[model samples]
Target: MSSSAILDAHQTAQALPYLALTQEIEALLQDPTVAVPPRIVQALHGGGSLFVMPAADARVAITKLISFIPTNAQRGLPTIQGDIVVFDVQTGQRIGLLDGPTVTARRTAAVSLLAAQHLAPRRDGPMLIVGAGVQGRAHLEAFHEGLGVQEFWIASRSASSADALVAHARSLGLQAQRVDDPNAALADCPWVVSATPAQEVVLSAPPHSDAFVAAVGAFTPRMVEWSAPVCQHLARTGTLVVDTRDADHEAGDLLQAGIDVAALPTLADVVGQTARWQNAHRPQGGPVFFKSCGWGGWDLAAARCMAQGIAVSSAPQG
Candidate 1:
């Protein structure tokens, strides 16, 4: 049995602030020694899956064990539930366990925000978010806090979910409204985040050039939020960047569009050359599409962020 301190969802989120999480993720991206093995998925008996994702670096290592069950929604339970186990590299001791769902939601949003900070043409306009689920809420907070975004336009298949998300956004003292059609709103909202399950296309129309769209919903080849033509158009005229190489196979929008993933740039590549790319290359590009499939490196970054916060709070002050 491991004697690791367990942090509940709220506590886990308190530790990994959006700003800090982005910093840690960017740091890990730049570190050549960090290693994130591809996630392993095991199908369960009842139409579910068990995911084992691991990532490590010189100082720490983390493994996120999670189970996803679609029927959990009917039971009023979270679809994804588990814990991220963190260990110290030198001591080889289990230091802490964080709420897995919270880490996943926050880290994924942070990754998008990190990319958006670099890719967005302008940050002051209303941001459009398709899907009003956990990722949508997380992305809202990340962009509002990280980039000072004040207005939001939300669209979802479920009207109640969209209204709920809009209310949540307004409660944060931000301006938020519901849009019946996400595609129509794309022209006005330069910053867009598509966080749906990606069963079908949620954003089909071609967005304006210089817009930044972070497609975070579709991870599998079968799931897609953007229409094939939209993806093809973006690939043709705009700049397309993915979160990781794994996206080459997992990002549905890119793969189904027959995009040459190897020919596109990764977020790490953009971050490494932010100045040069933004100045010289971005101007020549049309819209910017950033497709983020799940990555274990992000989970590891969240764990490290949480650990750093714990260390800071526990330190003896003079």
Candidate 2:
């Protein structure tokens, strides 16, 4: 029997490539036969997040637990870190262990890009990103690789941080600029993405007539990223798409900002192509918004792709 292989964080990181992983995930989502359940996400005290994601399709079952500890910053650790363990459905055997952060960041950004591809206006435009952390950088990379973004405007509370992110983007051959004012950045860019973790609003509604906004922060019931005016504007003019219907209802940003939860379409609806009706019902050429509370199915799909080489075998009988 083949021996089971163990993969450490660094090894897992070396195994997975962000752009290729994201492309594979996008293809899996486009397929109609995949079975991915709604993710279970919990918020712990002191700014932590725990998520359980499971996917099964008769042959195999993959589940991953991802935790985020924002307080780890004080310890000189990552704000987001975790692990992924895969299992074979038939024999209940452990098949693989993967780096959670790599999977999480890549899959999350891929999902956002998928949303953008399906919902955002079909044109090359400037993208304004309002965060300088891991998620923000992931969004920049994914957008550049997956979409036709011509320019990038980075905004953060710290100008230096924004400049650093812009420099990183420029290193990748993207036309990037650091902006002092997020609103000004939004006003100039037709596509805006909010990736911050603020408990309050960080950006006002952009006045652009054809802007598309992708808000991926604020997973917990206590956190929010957009103000009331922004939420209202999205509700009135744009179509709001979420990873799940339940997540849309539970998001504090939408609830606290007074945006009706019923107004958004589920990710399944969009993937299944049922959202065309919702789009047809909405007015033409308005701003479109998409918010995701994160989904596990995406993580499982990506991890399964990354676990291709590791050997899996039955354990010896006790």
User: Which candidate should be chosen as best, given lDDT against the real structure?
Assistant: 1
lDDT of 2 by residue, 90-200 (tens): 677776777787777777787788777777765567898998877888888888877857589999876877898899999998899988788866766878878886657
Q: Give the top-scoring candidate (TM-score).
A: 1
lDDT against the true structure, per candidate, is 0.88, 0.72
What number of backbone clashes does candidate 1 have, counting pairs of residues 3 or more apart or in separate chains? 0
Q: Model 1, residue 138: what's the lDDT?
A: 98
TM-score of model 1 vs. true structure: 0.94
Q: Which ten residues in a row have the lowest lDDT in candidate 2?
A: 308-317
* lDDT per residue (tens digit) for residues 191-249 in model 1: 89999877777778998777889999888777788988999998778888899888888
User: How many clashing residue pairs appear in each of the predictions shown?
Assistant: 0, 0
Q: After superposition, how far is residue 214 of candidate 2 from its true place, in Å?
A: 1.3
- lDDT score for candidate 2 against the true structure: 0.72
After superposing candidate 1 on the true structure, give the runs of residues whose Cα lies further than 4 Å from its correct spot: 1-3, 45-47, 274-282
Q: In model 1, which residue pairs have backbone atoms overlapping below 3 Å?
A: none
